[model samples]
Target: MSTSIATSHTATPHKGLPPGPKGTWIGGNLSQIGPRRVDFFLMLAQTYGPIASFRAGRWRLFLVSDPELIQQVLVTDARSYIKHFGARTFKPVLGNGLVTSEGDFWLTQRRLLQPAFLKTQVLSYAPVMAELTEAMLAKWVPGTSVDIAFEFSALTSAIALKTLFGLDDHGDRVRVDESLRLTFELLTHRLDSLFQVPLVFPTPANLRLKRAIADVNAVIDGFIAQKQAAPPGNDLLSTMIAAQREDGTQMTAQQLRDEAMTLYLAGHETTALTLTWSWYLLSQHPDVEQKLVAEWQRVLGGRAARASDLSALTYTAAVINEAMRLYPPVYVIGREATTDLELGGYRVKKGYTILMSQWVNHRDPKYFPEPERFLPERWLDGLASRLPKFAYYPFGGGQRLCIGVHFALMEAAIVLATVGQQFKFTLAPDAVIDIMPQITMPPKYGMPATLTRR
Candidate 1:
């Protein structure tokens, strides 16, 4: 692997970091980040151009809004960067899972887990995704209001656990669901807070978060104990259990727990948010919704969608893509510079935080015309192929690109096709939709919609 090491000496010692909005001496631009960092990032890109520098407390951050620079950081020169310190918040929960690890260890874990996310494996999980969505739709009564976010959260959680660990028993699944929800809520709460105390503190929020983590860990431990005794199964957890290294050794119990938790978080949260935003966008744009429904009807002939239907559901896929472009689930990607580097003509010093915002890039007018509008048709013309690689990365890019890209895409398409086939969601009268920026972006007030039977 090609890696860039941070150089204490600069080729041009006089050159400095890129320009950004000035801030307080100590706080820097952190105070400006406020509750809506996504918006602030967008504004920074608009105000200071693609590569901008700002300080948040003692931390140095460089926002790479330009697609080429983004590509440099994520794809062409990925080895020069590693997981940033901010990811430490997840370390308490994720352990040394794929998202948190770096170097040889991360590469080993990636290789071992790769087989589980291959094309054939992801395609096999589609029926479960569709079935779970169908089950969810079955519970929705016409004209009744529901929080689509919460509903999709439950649906995707079930799909994630089943696909990852072969969870089938309804009782155990419910317990996992409850625990996962509490854990995510606590995590999100912690992420949004500006002044976070250490987890060791007996603060109420920390206490609750600790309890939620323990509950989640217990659920995963149960899954591990059961899978340990059984024959190797088709699920991701089982695949990890059966995975062998160059030395023909398997992952340890702690490693298994780490991966399971990582999958549990990375697999479900973004997908649930993707579906939630898709439904919300569809509700707001009737023409898009009509086109989506028409595609489902034309493709499925009033039956449920299948993995086989994914290819035929082009418009359905486009709608989901467009929804993600508007409100990407993981809005920002962060990496730390391992060595000194020049990115987009700016001299990036070693140890600087590199921030790339999909929220900003996906909405840039240069790459996406009518950037603010929900226009799925734009995607139908192969725009993704023509535009820059990093322009529309809802699933990210390069080696560290989301391991579950195929799985998430197929799941989104199947869920939309199945759920859209039988029901259409209209935003509830009192619904106040806004972005809640966390590890995964979601609607702050929840997506309140009244489900109508088709």
Candidate 2:
């Protein structure tokens, strides 16, 4: 049975703005979207049609859920759009990195960095990924309770440190991890708050954010200086350090820092959340866990998963796909229009921000029957090929698609299989798991579970 959702980009006859929930005179829909943005965006799509309009402060925003509209915004008319103000909020930390830069500069940097993340290049890191994961498992003992979220975060962070910087020193990894946590938490706070405080104001929060950023920059700078002094290795930092532009000019120190920070943060955080959520879902669905382990046993047979083995681990990949379907790490992505446009028969003026949410689109019943159920088997067939392009985008779409898509998938699969073969988690009775939609969605209270040796 084909589960693909039929969608069309043929615009309806020009109408006024799409319907949406009304908001107060001063704040618009900012208050309504407080904290629970993922749920709020889903509600907007459910209550209104695909293209829903609202206001946040001075910004006119549209929550576009229809697959065709999403395609138009992300791919067809992508040139007419750029990342929204929300993404720019992290520029303090990300600098002019790929995630924060735009236009020609972003294109150049992307081109310079693209070859480093090629599938063939990424596959070489498989051994490092599995080794780091095995090292993590070596520390775990059955019947020991752990904060599963933190455990995975640490493991992925370590893997990222090794792959990105060629740093195996435990001390450097801890420093980077702590500073990143503080910086992101502060940045997320700034993003969620309606009122803005200038970073130069020396306010308590601004001061804290500044210090956190400084700490992260200092660590990155140290790594760069070390990389510059040493012989070039195969790590991402070394690649970026040696990357040159078309004019034969190498990336300046600042550019290297920006790109390194962007890759470092982007590389680990999302994959960690993927593993975290995968474990949570598998814990809740034992039958699915059993099947996943069975596949691993038949294929891996007491060995760590390799990049070549990824193709044969059908059930393992399905579990990851299903996990992402239910709880996408980057649940929502927004773009601001560069010119006036029409979408879903509504006029979208210049400067309007459009949000395309995976949380909403991934749950659309047209594409996913019984959308809330954790069903990995749904992806075992040719469902991905059958689905419309933007209907199930987890990493996103368009020219600006995540460069680390293959790397993240490979790391997630290797880590999932290696860890799953050794142990399974049982959620603690008192554990409270809820989504906290920050830059990436993580459990609000953290996932507490007991490790049960498989």
Candidate 3:
């Protein structure tokens, strides 16, 4: 269904509430910030204090950085909003996937798929995670530099495709890469086309997106058909297929396709981004790196890291959190109001697409002392809990909280430990790092780091 557009803009002429920087009628302050979305948020925070408002393509976005304000929107009246165009724009590619769907459909799919990512189920995937890391490590030669971001991307791809879909070790790596490359292209092309026509048109970029969607859909279809023809199995595919509501109503094929596709995208994509920047942080802070390695030595002791090891690795976990504060994978969570609501003394009328940006909230100097510096020890000082839940949201908040929160954390810690115990990496000098904003934020320069066995 074509998404309903009620007001198409935050056109309300409200009287009371904090002031925001002025804007043009059509694009608002959107043009002030560069195309890099994160940079834009940072600029807005500098100009209009932590809480501000702006317009983007007819959407009235309240760009919030205050943890208290973030909590009001994400938790208090959360049901009043659902994923706005930012996320709903993904529906064409993701269908009713847990990340894209809304209403009862989203809630139901989330309930069914919830168990697959629970702590125990996630722990069950640890050995496979370890094996995959070692396999990727075997391909690496010591004292050689590699784009660690790309390597982690490929590694997570292998891990996700294997554990989630039960693909073979010698499976079609070429096909998977083709799909990933194309799907990412499609996602970005559409984002750039925000003011243009719908992307399903005959434009070159649109056609490329179409082709990429087909490439990925074909693989997903094949996987599901094979599973349907056989008996139930243990991988995420079978788990999603076999899942039933309390009333025993199983997900239909389309629903299965949606949920499976969601898992395929999320199983490792977000975690890979986290680990990629994490290694960068570790390289910049040698003391943190030394501490993490020491923790790995003391706890893992040349063995595979498990979910259980996460608690004891304070500095290591802090490094991950610190990296996320700088480079959050999901930089922003958007919402469209279903009712005329009053938020923080402001009239948030029906259809205003509010934006709660983690990129802004996390870097606010008030919450994070010297937000730019890499200080992992600050995290251990009960800093995370001292802040409100919505204050430092990397997984977001409320009903729409990321289902893969634990899954991503578990995967990251294990992979960090595995790689830390085995190798150390340093960034190549003068490497031009950039940010390519998409469904998730990723490093643009392809983080290259020289690696050697410790």
- TM-score for each candidate, following the candidate numbering: 0.93, 0.96, 0.91
Better of 1 and 2 by TM-score: 2
Off by over 4 Å in 1: 1-14, 169-196
Q: Which ten residues in a row have the lowest lDDT in candidate 3?
A: 1-10
Every candidate's lDDT: 0.83, 0.87, 0.77
How good is model 2 by TM-score? 0.96
Q: What is the lDDT of residue 81 in candidate 1?
A: 93
Best by lDDT: 2
- Clashing residue pairs, candidate 2? none
| Ranking 1 against 3 by lDDT, winner | 1
Cα lDDT tens digits, model 1, 1-454, are 0111232222454387777899998778877898789889888888887777888777899988877778878887799999886776677778899999998999999988888789998888887887777777778899998999988887887888788888764566567667766666677666555567888889998888888778778888887888878888888888888888899888988999999889887888888899999988888899988888888878898887888988888998889889999999999999999998877666778899999988988888877778899999998988878987887898889888899999889888888888888888888887889987767787888898888888
> What is the Cα-based lDDT of residue 224 in candidate 3?
84
Put down candidate 3 lDDT per residue, 221-337, tens digits, no spaces.
Answer: 777887778777788788877777878798888878777777877887789899998988788888889888888889989887876777888777888899888889989888888
Position 118, candidate 2: lDDT: 94
Per-residue alpha-carbon lDDT of candidate 2 for residues 264-347, written as tens digits (9 for 90 to 100):
888899999999999999989999998998899899998999999999999999999999999999998999998888776677
